[model samples]
Target: MLSIALLGLLVVSAAASPSAIKDRTGRVVHKRTTEIVQLYAYGTNISGLPIYAGSDNLAYLATDDAASNFTAVTWTIDTTGTDAWTVSANTTAATNSSTLSSGSTFYVVTDSSSDDSFAQAGFVSDASDAPSGATTTGIVTYGPYVMILEDTDDKDTYVSEFWATQSDTDGVWTLMWNEAGTAQDNSVPVTLKTTAPVV
Candidate 1:
């Protein structure tokens, strides 16, 4: 159940503790980790805020979680000849990453990764898309690019994804859930990953 949860998020990131990743025989692997994708949401009130899978099972920005030591999901967008993408986090358990579509609709949810204990893989793969790959690592800082979002329930209708500073009971501001329905702001982004943000 937990492993499936880890592979649920459409995207992902991590806050590694310099722990050497070893194989079955305990030999330290030297491969690069998953290339982290930063999801910067653009809303009427919020723009460029990092979106993360919240403890409440919704998407929240860094402004929402001021002290949880939050780290968003890491991902790699496949740009094969055709304009198609897949949401299969088939990367080795060492990386635990997968392939997601270029412009598909996905949902973010809380998982159990030490990175944040949350993951959301709600995007659906199309038949025409090609296989995705995982080969990049480190902080990706050049793109505030628009990775258009779609609704998890209805991929036909597009939605503007964003996060709010509005707090719930514990004062953590997150936008997510379990059940599905119609809402205004359905699609949001989890952006711009940097383990050590400028201080």
Candidate 2:
């Protein structure tokens, strides 16, 4: 009985192979390769802020869904053709830092090596009232790596800006999203990385 079960399992595994398929003409059919490679990462939020402070090359996507705040999230990365991607970060080489307003969106991309930090510089200011803290939630993930920026900002803004960044670095690229100005009360730092083709 054991021998029979083992034999059956072997047969099933063999049949699952792509080469096992055949056409009516008695020719073997090959499976087409997937064009896009997707990467994923997940983490928890602290005090309404989402942080991705670990070892991985994941980038964060900014979103505006209120119900999705401060929860586990799955982010996807689709790429083909070349190893490098062109994308933008709110912080640049010149400014090298910026403030994430109370209801704004931003992104952070890290490399395979180095520490990455994604944090708010200070509470969003309102001239007529007290400073407003950013109330957002979601996960920054891992595997290869991922960082998620949570807020009630426009999702399209982040997507469009990412496309623009890709346009800037058509072949090779680096992403930066460091916060500048006054550091918040609960700011935590982590590893950062630059994303290029996996070449």
Candidate 3:
């Protein structure tokens, strides 16, 4: 019985070993197969900007036509330096401006008047005293010397442009713009916490 058991073990071990074949000339033969894979790419039209420290203000400007398609907006920060930030969408058409946090800023632009199609821009300053009102033209000053000037019209492609002073505390902070093209006619300002190299 012990000899029979040992023989069964040997048979099991041989079956588990890698299989091999020999050619007619006593040479080894091997078979191999290759597989091809295809990757898919999707469209991302919305993105947020980088966050910088300086003043404590929030301001924005919109054109007359912006009132038709623009909707609720928000901001985010990128801690991974990957130029990615979180976004919070506002579904209501009643509000257009938002007060940002000390380390973050963000904005959203939409296609439908329902305030659904939103796009995000980069941050400028952390000024809290920035102006807040619905106006076609004006200069609003927030804390620490940051200003927002908005000029928009039916003929222009860019509906807004934002600028902020570099932070005095840490010169490391910088502004970043969205790489996505203007699929929809809108640009909203926002602040994102990002570690992405300054661009």
Candidate 4:
């Protein structure tokens, strides 16, 4: 079976905010704007050496050279049952069960409407059916950062950076996330943290 590990999968909704306007009578009026929802393009192979992270507030897994390319990695979340949760990456017949050399790097980037203390962890690998090797990416490294989108006409600008990593002890890559639904509706927030293995 082909498997992958998802590093950082997060869904964030723009919270409601009031716009103040001055009336002729010297009174202030507050108006709410429409809420926008979006999805990420990051997926991980739990059994693979290459992990994943969130880019542009969505799921994305990309290399260092093409770090800004958000579409590099794509994944879909499935929540069929209470205990049944999984995340799958779109792979071709040729890429499936492929091998990832050591020293490979994966990055996860995101944007937010507010400066949030984003925290993530639980680095899992995907299942695999590939040939076993001797040496693996002993330990994977992850880096998280934010890119501000200031070209918009609105002042409600936000961005976030997050990342994670793992080691390929078996020298095979075929991992993915066993988490549920993608792009969640975050009505409330509690806390955030980040974790991973060192090279």
| Most accurate candidate by TM-score | 1
**Best lDDT among the predictions, by candidate number:** 1
Overall lDDT per candidate, in order of appearance:
0.35, 0.28, 0.29, 0.24
Model 4 residue 198 CA deviation (Å) reads 37
> Compared with the true structure, what per-residue lDDT tens digits does model 2 show for residues 1-94?
9999999999999888986887796655555322222222111221122221111222232222321211222212222111111122222112
State in Å the error of residue 129, model 4: 20
Please write out the lDDT profile of model 4 over residues 1-199, one tens digit for every residue.
1232222221111122233454586444335222111122222332111333332222223333333322222222111111111223324212323233222222221222332313232112322321122111111111221122222463423332222222232222111221221232321111111222233
Best of the two (1, 4) by lDDT: 1
lDDT of 2: 0.28
Residue 94 in candidate 1, Cα distance off native in Å: 20
**Which ranges of candidate 1 are over 4 A from the true structure?**
1-36, 64-69, 79-165, 169-172, 176-199
**What is the C-alpha lDDT profile of model 1 across 73-164, one tens digit per residue?**
43443321113222223233222123433333333332232323223323434432311311111112223443223325534232222224
Q: lDDT at 94 for candidate 1?
A: 27
State every prediction's TM-score relative to the real structure. 0.32, 0.19, 0.20, 0.19
- For residues 1-199, write the lDDT of model 3, one tens digit per residue: 9999999999888656443455586533333211111111111221222232212222222322332322333433232112323233334434434443333333222123433333223333332321231121122222211123333442312222232222232222123222232233332333222122223
Q: Look at candidate 3 and tell me the lDDT of residue 198.
A: 29
